[model samples]
Target: MSATPSSKLPPFDPRDPLGLDDLLTDEDRAVRDTVRQWTADRVLPHIAQWYEDGELPGIRELARELGALGALGMSLTGYGCAGASAVQYGLACLELEAADSGIRSLVSVQGSLAMYAIRRFGSEEQKQQWLPRMAAGEVIGCFGLTEPDHGSDPAGMRTYAKRDGGGDWVLNGRKMWITNGSVAGVAVVWAQTDDGIRGFVVPTDTPGFTAPEITHKWSLRASVTSELVLDDVRLPAAAVLPEAKGLGGPLGCLSHARYGIVWGSMGAARTCFETALDYARTREQFGRPIGGFQLTQAKLADMAVELHKGILLAHHLGLRMDAGRLRPEQVSFGKLNNVREAIEICRTARTILGANGISLEYPVMRHATNLESVLTYEGTVEMHQLVLGKALTGGLDAFR
Candidate 1:
């Protein structure tokens, strides 16, 4: 059988997907269609309220629904995941983020950061212990690597894990800016061992584990960010992720999360672009719709062009990743370029909308605001610049 119209391949528009490509198999089409409709109906109706409330009220339920749709770690081949291709995973991120970045962050952190770590490094037993529950969203998970003092430089972590009197590991340190921290039942925490940085799975109920909510976030307001305190927190030796050692482990997980950002940010741009297109066609200026004006059309054109480039870039990267040939630097390229361009697109779209852009009634300003966080997190633009710089030059001047 042929692919669906949504894949945007040959017989589909090269410049845009436009739901005309037979690229995605019928199953993928169905998945994309399902998420698109769900986001439009379930999320759009209540998104403004959630945004205003500064919290996702029905997130557990929402997460469970996503799990049912095979969104959690959707690209991973097994472990109750969707077992979708990388493109499908990108599509899922796109749909979620089109609703809101915070919504997408919830899924991305859970799937790419938390679940990918376990799936990549967890033992079969550990996988069996937690994957299914997390996949179902019955239990939530978070990744903790960025400490209060160690933001960009995670390797300088002070969170320490030492072998205890009985062979268990006792952890002590603070993890800040953690997503899903307050609600996570299980957290994949990184800490310094004698062997360098290692990750551990700590149950939130662990005696000394406490995560207090970090409030007043002007960005990603609908998502939860918090501080995780490990005061003599202890875990079994089995809690250790034996498959990984040193910074490579968490960095690997970050590469996964960064891939999602590449698509997710573009999703935000798509929303802004679409909103601006509609506004331009309607809001009267001078004697006709502002879209008639050269300046307005030019702004819309730029948004469209940049959005298309971002989409194609992400799709190409997804193709490479599916083939197991993608690199960290490539991810850095996508994350950095797409977010930077998408943010500009949203800002441009907002400017065309004039005052209405800042209103919650329109999507551009919110996407623009959320893009600020997206630009900084998952390795900042500068970090990715250095990553690419190192790729091009034999010299390593990132930190030095």
Candidate 2:
């Protein structure tokens, strides 16, 4: 008997063993294919080099291209946004992270964090001034919430905004580990105020505002990270985001980004699993393919099972978000499970690749390294665990 292209070996499904594609609408599939093709054409070929160089060259150009594709702020309504469904946005994230987590971070910060802040809470004037250009990619934005001393504990932030006698605002603070910080045209900075924690739209070129690039990071190397310094940067009263106040403001934006990560992590896992499967089929050991052995088969089977399950979880969360019924704890549930499993899948794939897995020639090691950052940011694994713990225990406060 001979093998046919359609029936070759175990029947490749791109790690989607449950036929989940049938659940997606036509528009959803279209969105996924568009992003997948765009990443293949624009990102994958150059990503390894970009990762090695520790910088994303032509980032502004890339932003503009993403805008043209209606990918930036794709799920938002109006202001030149694509106004696509939440599922479409999740699909887009999956495709982007399949290429590189840094690429997905770029989109997530722009659409989910920066643009979402302005859209959800900005005053009409603020939205009229920024969101259109940002959606079009002519203007870039960064979210400033985390500080040099504050990560999970944003309430302890020292960044402060004071009101002058003339009613103008003066902001003084430093925000650390901000993605797209140095390259942004505008920054949505959150500062402690007499009223509470408040968000302000600060132009990046303000006299006392400076975003210096952070150097020598071992993870997310292809993405730009920076420290935002606001040394008495003054702004008009109109710069304030009127609708947002307290810790809930920034936490809301994080919920959006974390939801995207639930899908994006699975994309990285799929890539690693596919790469390993291909290698196992062709790479021989002791005069036979390594995949023929039971141990290798076990590793591959486990990875495939987790990868598909994570994708299903992401899809379910997207549907909830689209229906406006998704909770923050639910997003945490998906993020915690998907990112942890994705990293494990990547590591398992790395072991299957042997020495070659650690090399940049293949993407397994790079995805593994990027997952380390993903596991910590947008709420750490422990943080999510506490979130679920509290939810399950009926208002138990574990972190406190």
Candidate 3:
């Protein structure tokens, strides 16, 4: 199925009847409308089958289209990027995730994690090598940070890279829970250097570099996740990202990824909320519309309230980021609050369907399950708390 001929993409119709425009700037609205149109055309019509098949075949091509629209790395400046405002990026995220969190995961990892990592840390040569292909979706990239034993505490990561003679390096370690690992043509891997932790751009074909797809996962099934095993992989000095140093380097990338999650999760919540609302309005209870009752209204009301607040929080944080005053802890704050609220919204929306919620005919259950992964990854719930606690008390005690 193709998108309706309508050039606009607000729910069911365009023209701002819902007044969501009040939440967006003109630029943000334009970006959102474009992505929403793309998703409706490319994703929604085919998603149920893809969801059933457990894979989205068009993801890579869809990513390239997003890149052309400047949706990929839109917030980043220069190097063939959109360089748009962070608020606009947030709106793009919302529209993409409104389609599915798994697809949104692809965008966030490519744009925020992979592209941002290279742009922020890599040497000029490395950026020139990867950023252009990535922005064009010609080469997919994944961030390899969490290890088998270091999901919650990456500093404890055992992956190590040692400098050999002639500016060459040998890397050995396993990276766990890597998104896009299976399909990525490039991987941004962090390893412990003799001096400290450092990041590397390891091509997937590097000898001894292998990523085995993780299968039968209940969460984020439509997205690819894999374990990257680096068995004495060799790299040139150019592999090292020059500007990023210390723990802040990888953590900085996580902060960028989390900001995208803040917006993306709201899209997931909105989908489930809307599904539940429509169900309530049509699914008869005692020969009366469930939506007419106070109980169903209460659930819809809560979902709306939470989704609205999450979007506002993400939108405000986007402004701060554009101002260059946003702190890592602030990113953590949005990641923590919005994801939690979105998960709750999904759960409540799922309950509105009674038994039908668990069925694939509805998206609430899938969104809820995927939200579980969203909450756990990208500096888990407790880790964000530690970050926020440190911000206030100057103490980073909890996740260390």
Best TM-score goes to which candidate? 2
User: Model 3 over residues 18-49: C-alpha lDDT tens digits?
Assistant: 45568777777788989999989888887767
Candidate 1's C-alpha runs over 4 A off are: 1-23
- Cα RMSD to the true fold for all candidates: 3.9, 3.4, 5.9
lDDT by candidate, in order shown: 0.88, 0.94, 0.86
- TM-score of model 1 (CA atoms): 0.94
Tens-place lDDT per residue, model 2, 216-307, is 99899999899999999999999999999998999999999999999999999999999999999999999999999999999999999999
Q: lDDT score of model 3?
A: 0.86
| lDDT for each residue of candidate 1 in 215-259, tens digit (9 for 90 to 100) | 887788889888999999989999999898999999999999999
The runs of at least 3 residues in candidate 3 whose Cα sits more than 4 Å from the true structure, single-residue gaps closed, are 1-20, 394-396
Mark the regions of model 2 whose C-alpha exceeds 4 Å error after superposition: 1-14
lDDT of 3 at 317: 95
Which has the higher lDDT value, candidate number 1 or candidate number 2? 2
